[model samples]
Target: MAYPFKEILQRFWGYTSFRDLQEDIIESVYLKKDTLGLMPTGGGKSITFQVPALAMDGICIVVTPLIALMKDQVHNLLKKGIKAAAIYSGMRREEIAITLDNCIYGNYKFLYLSPERLETELFLSKLAHLNVSFITVDEAHCISQWGYDFRPSYLNVGNIRKLKPNCPVLALTATATLLVVDDIQEKLGFSKKNVFRKSFKRENLAYKVEYSENKFNRLVELLVQHSGSGIVYVRNRKMTKELAEFLTRNEIPASFYHAGLDSFVKDKRQKAWTENKSRIMVSTNAFGMGIDKPDVRIVVHFDIPDSPEAYFQEAGRAGRDGEPATALLLYSKTDVSNLKKSFTNAFPEKRFIRTVYHHLMNYLQVAIEDGIGRTFDFELGKFCKAFALNVVQANNALNILERSGLIQNTDTRENNSRLYFLAGKEELFGFQNQRQEYEELIKTILRSYSGLFSSYVYISEQTIAGRTGLSNEQVYQYLVNLDKAGLVKYIPQKKTPTITLLKDRVPENIITISKSIYEEQQERMKRRVDAMLYYISSDIICRSQILLAYFGEKKSKPCKICDICTSNGQQKDLSGSIRKAVLDKLNRTGSTNINELIRDLTYDKEKSMEVIRFMADNGDILLEDKQIKINS
Candidate 1:
């Protein structure tokens, strides 16, 4: 099948040429084959499907769980003169029906929706009438039980493929293990294992790990030395701020980001960090999923990540512009201990999981076989306080329930306040004149914004308040009154977690959390944790090779720039065995007196002392009084 891909790219994206494997992946899909494209974080994964869908004859159905991403892409596509529509939770039934009707009649080239939407009777009944050129499964890793961040909703995509059997499926993911790769293909029912992978090797990004006694000082020294835009990843919201302030105290301009922040604050801080107004961004893993600022010089992990997939995805954010960058992990013994505890907390017992599910249903007041298509704003702190549940354990149980397909909670809250005029201009004018009380607010809104009658427009409460000389709270009340009066359709701004029930509330006993969802996933987490543990401890292989081999790449050349490779010469002289033996003993046992450790080494006394001194100087070991210990 011949495609005018270059013309489409030039016309819409203004790209003169396609990146490494993009054209090939697009061609394979264009030829009506089930194709999986494994691209890294910065790889042009979207273009593989979008360009081909545009070149084809019909609309492309995109299934993804990221509502924010769907809206963003649909908006960008519309800006490029390509009609696109997105259907997700929180939309009124009438609004969804209108969108589906538009897709059936209008020649929209793209229809982006959540995976849960595919099985809806409304969507399925309309599916037969629409010409779907292809199906694009974004974040395709979620279909695999072994993949990090698995979502049960993604499994329904195959059923949709069976309905549109002629339409090819293009699965795209940023990170996947070998197990996840095969699982994705099998679960998606591929005709054959036709996969296109852009190599995961980032030559410009050097991977490094350090065992340090004082990680904070080490972090500061790294930032001082590197001197460019970098990210420091900590574990929780509180730590993000503390570390960012720590960096600032040391004269490093920094910002912090987490899911808990207000949407406007998030945007402001993110813009500052990305535009180089802030030299460092100390954040949780929540930051940097879809952000596309290349040329990041370094990424510092203050704590260890459980999975290599996550580590790779987060670390890949650096060196995206192909310049020299470094991914540095600073770990201590405490961090390793914390990571193990986290693994246990991430998968609670099945009975406890069931109990949490029951409590969750009760808390939401969802009756059995009811509220299947409903969405409720969820606040973790409030729920935990009411149930007296440990925040971490309860949150983990909810995730397990989500993986079991009972409900889904997108932990991030978004969207600003939106208003749409329900009554026409004449009717609104007459009501405002008669009501008299709502006159100024109505006039203020009418003069301040456009498109109120046509569609939903994002309106800021603060902006409205400033203009009308009313407090923000008062403005909110007035908007609610107007909504009740049928003068406008108002959706107040939300920054709370939202849970969407995918299935009717079932009894806790009947909720079957599958072995694949629980046991195998637990085992997968253990493997990822072990691999990460080994990656830090191993000195015989290059750091990059350890990460690459984890993702199924073997026989890659050593990146002579990584910590292991760069230190090889010293290791050759001092004997890597000496460094390995000292660390191994410490890991097995606790801190040992320096005299006893030296005696146990069995090497020449002076040589043993030399190795110990080298380690201590490199910040890998610490000595207090006469006792010696591994730094982390």
Candidate 2:
């Protein structure tokens, strides 16, 4: 029998009821059915699987592509007193082996892992021993080629399903079109067509578009007017820093975030913002996944997003607590033109793509038919410098190579430093006493960590430094000295992207680009870009309606709080009615003096002149020689 889900939710999460379709999704998964859930951002997606996992008899395996997300979920679960563990890239073999063994014997309820780990021998060997309740795939849209941010690694999810055929599958995503929806179902080996989707209409959030020549000034004005925590999204890393600095100069408590920052710095900045130490986070798209701060009053897009899906997901980050919030997009005509140019740069010419392919092989020192299944620490700037290639075009070519299955690039977070004793306790004691300088550091390491004698352990240099009253650099140097003396073996942390060769290198002439597939993807991208551009350029259409209709909601009502709706509503007030009446009289009489119109219409003379002035400014009428005439 299943556990009481409502009781668990209240006991663990302190919620009285599930939001939207969350209860239904949990029930479907509890009944051992394959399900797909399309919940918008902050739709409580984690609970759909998390609550079910708690009520089940065995563990649930969660597969995702983002290491940060996996770590965050695991951390949150642990804080809730739920037993969870995760295995990701950059972990040692011994550590992974021990983690997998714990799942079998330690009664761990959840095991989070990346899709690449599914193809490993260690994981496959341990797959049959433990019972799995269900399989949850987060960010399921990546399985579809039609979706933005596609990852080929996500395709391995189907293989995991085959290993645990009895277990159900629950797939979740924040944004997906009809095409992507169908593709996810087929790719993930869904048992049947079981899907639960929440409506994408955010009634309480106002979507606003501002056209401005000086965007920085307008941004500052908006921030001052709307007082609350917020996020300002820029396009590149440099912009993240520059904008954050600009906000600070204006007296706003702000900081910048990007993927290139160190892991410790990222954690510190994110914590400060989450706790309200900082009022705003100016960042790239790398920020704001799995963030639980609910009172973000605004989300500003300083740069135009590449697609509507990305825009909707990022904009939906606001108003998670269900209070009133706003999603503001600030852009100019020049920005739109630049976006068009970027689209061309995003997919370079076929010849250029092939050139990048050859150059990458040479850069990595891989000969033809060699370097299969090898991972390299790749630096994009270094590669571009070595070949004299344009950075934008070069990165786009790398993306094309990834889509073509030539290589895979993963942005890995830095792992913590690791070390273990190479000598026995007696030998280490003798050495430490003989050296006299290393005794305190050795004792501190022993107190902070255990079981280091037989296996390598993840250790924090900062923690050790604090305990021993030494600097982190001193601690690191002492560890290196110990390693050189054969008292310990140390592995410093790694903090760079890993590029893996999927297939053996082939000659540039034999490289194949599927014409139909390429053309179809290009066409789909064009439509998405066009839709985003339309959202920015349109002034008369409801912003909410466009977003809703794009996500397959064909009959959504206009959100009356959007910029367009608000403007149109304001134009229909009493003044607007009076203006229409005055226009009618003028059209009939051809022209009229102010005093004559006021006397004939018998309306308020001051209000009448105000309406006339508004009309004249908006090009509805012309006032020449004190006569009001409608403009032709």
Write down the lDDT that model 2 would get: 0.85
lDDT tens string, model 2, 173-239? 9999877898899998887889899999998899999999899989999999999999999999999
Minimal lDDT window, size 10, model 2:
568-577
lDDT by residue for model 1 (22-70), tens: 9999999989999999999989888999999998999999998876677
Residue pairs in collision within model 1? 333-632
Backbone clashes counted, model 2: 0
Clashes of each: 1, 0
Best by lDDT: 1
lDDT of each: 0.85, 0.85
Q: Which parts of model 1 are misplaced by more than 4 Å?
A: 368-371, 421-487, 572-632
